[model samples]
Target: MKRAHFIYLLLLWCIPMMGIAQIVPENPSSGALQSVQNLQVSDVPNDAGDEINISWDFPDDLDKSQITEIRIYRSTSASGPFRQIDAFPLVLDSYTDADDDETGHIVTPKDTYYYKIGLFNGSEEVTSQVSEGVSPQISFFNWGRLNVFIILGIYFALILYFIRASRKGREIYIRTLPGLEALEESVGRATEMGKPVLYMPGIDEANNIQTLYSMVILRYVTQLVAEYETPLIVTVGKAFVVPLAEETVRQGYMDAGRPDLYNQDIVRYYSDEQFAAAAGVSGVILREKPATNIYLGSFYAESLILAETGFLTGSIQIAGTGNIHQLPFFVVACDYTLIGEEFYAASAYLSEDPKLLGPLKAADWMKILAVGFIGVGAVLETFGIDLFPRLLQI
Candidate 1:
């Protein structure tokens, strides 16, 4: 009986200690910040439909000194398996949950979502009550792009006004392009010498803007060549350019009322290999001893080779390309070189068609306006006036 009483008392004493061991202590960081209140969610205004704005009142009783960050969470329902959206400092009272392509959010319209803002200190998270459901709706028009819309309207108006004026028989004067002016002289020289005129319409694909511009100039050149009855030899670098160039040459002959003299074999396709085409064109120059060489199109490393060959053959070379790096080669090797917009302007100056001339005149006016604005902006910057530059940013 004595031994049984001693064992029962020891068991009683050990039960209290085991209970104490099982109890977990509360985290001190849990109460570091008071909960956020009055959380608000609304649709973002004047935006594409995949955005929503979130805002909340900062907790009044929070100790900001101890707090590190406030985290945001989003879910489809109030009883959520919530996912973290982002984190912000305690100073921010709002956030925008918009689709960020760079972040791979990939947000879509009309999907309702709930949000929860969590107050965090160290590793502890103390969350606020879930926000009410919010959904994004598509906006009909974006007012933020109003400035761009106005600028485009002004540009179109300028073009239309100039076109209408041009049609009324008002003469538009274009600055002279020496390279374009030499076209007539070169064709005439070839005619007088009884030698062929060699023309190379760049090696780039037809879709390139520079190549397209070259074709436009070529169309005008063909008319002159046909009128002078000068033999024209066009060597192409791409197979796709062959058909378009042939048609352009044929049309030019027809327009000149000398369709019978149009030769289909004149526009020939050379190898697409850059150096091979350059070598072939160089051989043609040496063999035919052409009096004039016109190379207008996109050019790469082969620009200097062709120009040098033509220079050696004593041909009056007129070359035009937008490639800035290759321009110096043409300038040194060719008789006259068309730089930058001069190459584009050649088509308008040569055609003198009101349809083309009007846009050209408006473009010139636009350039003048741009230069004037730049000059004014530079002067205003000295006075700490930033409004002028800011106005042109959009």
Candidate 2:
């Protein structure tokens, strides 16, 4: 029993000694194996002064077997009570020091900082000499986004020029859109047939750009309806769009000098659920048997359900949306359809307001310029010439 106790104590003591032997190198000269090469520290460019870059080259005579990872230590002063901030595998020789961790060592633009790179083995660490001071700086501009800046400047300039020209009564030639042309006729037919006209601005929320675009067209549609004194129904899927639709209809009637004819019940809110909204709009179509049905905005799977139901009601359907997948259904079911960009440009076309026309003209010219650039870039790249792409890099 005494011998067993002695053996246990001996094993415990020997294990600790072995660990210490591995951790503390028997020869102090082992550090020579991890000597850092051409250590460099500098401010990171194109930044808001919250980061600095530290870089070094591995020694040519590095022992890949002996090293596991490299650790980064930082301090505000050159001679530091330094604390480690980061660690990575030995294969990497660079670090970007940022205040990602809100620890004791903070990086800021005002203070010059020092760094040390330490090569860590499983049990021991060999640290490099202190790096030269570097401070993060606040750059006024980043040259990397120069392409985007130039493009935006050109677009704005085009917009401004067209606006001035339009105000001066310069005639901007606009192509006729079929779906927009049928809007007035649709309302007129509804008035003649003594049937209601249904308009659904789509299943999208009020904030969507497509919904906003549809609202512009809605103003035009309501104007036509108000002129004919026909019963008009505007059903919206989202609650947020209810008030917007109501106000738009009210304003349209006022614009047509028929505000007294406008009733609050003209615009109604259906369910928020996609299919549920489709069902409600479908129910409206079956019950009212409207002479005309107009759909504009973004939609997904429920587009076909709405369009098909209106088609069966024998309504002269007019459909427009930015969603490409829904275009196929609208084209087959609707008498007139506006695809993609046409739907966006319809508001400008129908209103002829300079504020809207100016941007439309600018966008057309921008697309022309873009196509030219793409063609030129493709040819240049085919011939191994990189000049065009280099100028437009973003």
Candidate 3:
């Protein structure tokens, strides 16, 4: 009887162990790796370009201890005979393609690449479904003759709509009192005082949207200065923007038919150091005593110092920055400021170019749709009804 009782106790302990093994299955079921969650890609920085980062989370049934290695594969086609490009020892749940120590792959604009990850445990392997093909999207306006017709068609339609709207006398709800208006007055004041008008394109490359927008506004402002035969000085902090700003200013003068009045020396490049650039611009303001100062672009901590110095110099300051934190300082010191999207809209507003205005109007209409949807959703929820609750499920 004693021997039998001991044997029963042993069986009871073993039963729990057996159940544990069954509950935590040693091998995952087929199609266990169905969900590929948290996939993200972003442009890589500080390179000649044409590089992107790809990363994803591991499968749900993934056994961290059993995973010996992870295999990475790449394919040009989505349904592909994927070729193994990289293999990493399972140290973490995620892997970054660009940072891998192995032979790095250089991406080309012409080729679209898809990625697949495989988790290996000795002989057994679980492969992830292939990622969607990723290729560089060519800008519609930049691409050759193939896209020219599409671009022209868009512009033509916008022009026709603007003309029709004008004829119909439609009341467009455009708000008055933009911040850049003060900059215009500042430029006019500088022209009268015989002092230069100073403009700074933010300290970033041409690829930066903020820098591009700054140049666009600069074009319009320079044209005004040219008409007044005023001296306009543009100091850029980035080497790439130097030539672009010069071209923009030169083109503006040419368009004004006063190329002779354009001063090449005024549009210059300064040191790329954030604080040093601020100091240099301060020196320019103090020495040159510019009657009007315009700061439009992506600015950091240096924005306040620049604006404050320009303010002290008795120059009419107009600042526009996409940086949310800097907006406060610009507001406190600058006479007029373009906040966020308003800065981008300046070119469209000044030129009254229909090509730009149509998109702006369309965007406003989309915003109205968004606000209406939000309001309707709130009302529905208050009444304990969900119009599209299934959308929140995934």
Candidate achieving the largest lDDT: 2
The candidate with the higher lDDT, 1 or 3, is 1
Deviation in Å, model 3, residue 329 alpha carbon: 1.8
Q: Cα lDDT for residue 350, model 2?
A: 87
- lDDT string for model 1 (98-140, tens) is 8999989845675789999888877787798999998788888
What's the TM for model 3? 0.61
| lDDT by residue (tens digit), candidate 2, 223-277 | 8888898999999999999988988999989999999989989998988999988
Higher-scoring candidate on TM-score, 1 or 3 = 1
Cα lDDT, all candidates:
0.86, 0.87, 0.76
Ranking by TM-score: 2, 1, 3
Candidate 2 lDDT score at position 234: 95
Question: Candidate 3 residues 248-367, lDDT tens each?
Answer: 999999999999987779787878888888888889999998988889999988888989999999988888878888999999988888888788778777877555666566556556
**Model 1: how far residue 305 lies from native, Å:** 3.0
Instruction: Name the regions of candidate 2 deviating beyond 4 angstroms.
Output: 1-44, 53-72, 86-107, 117-122, 125-129, 205-207, 271-276, 286-289
Winner of 2 and 3 under TM-score: 2
What ranges in model 1 sit over 4 Å off? 1-75, 78-106, 113-148, 271-280, 286-289
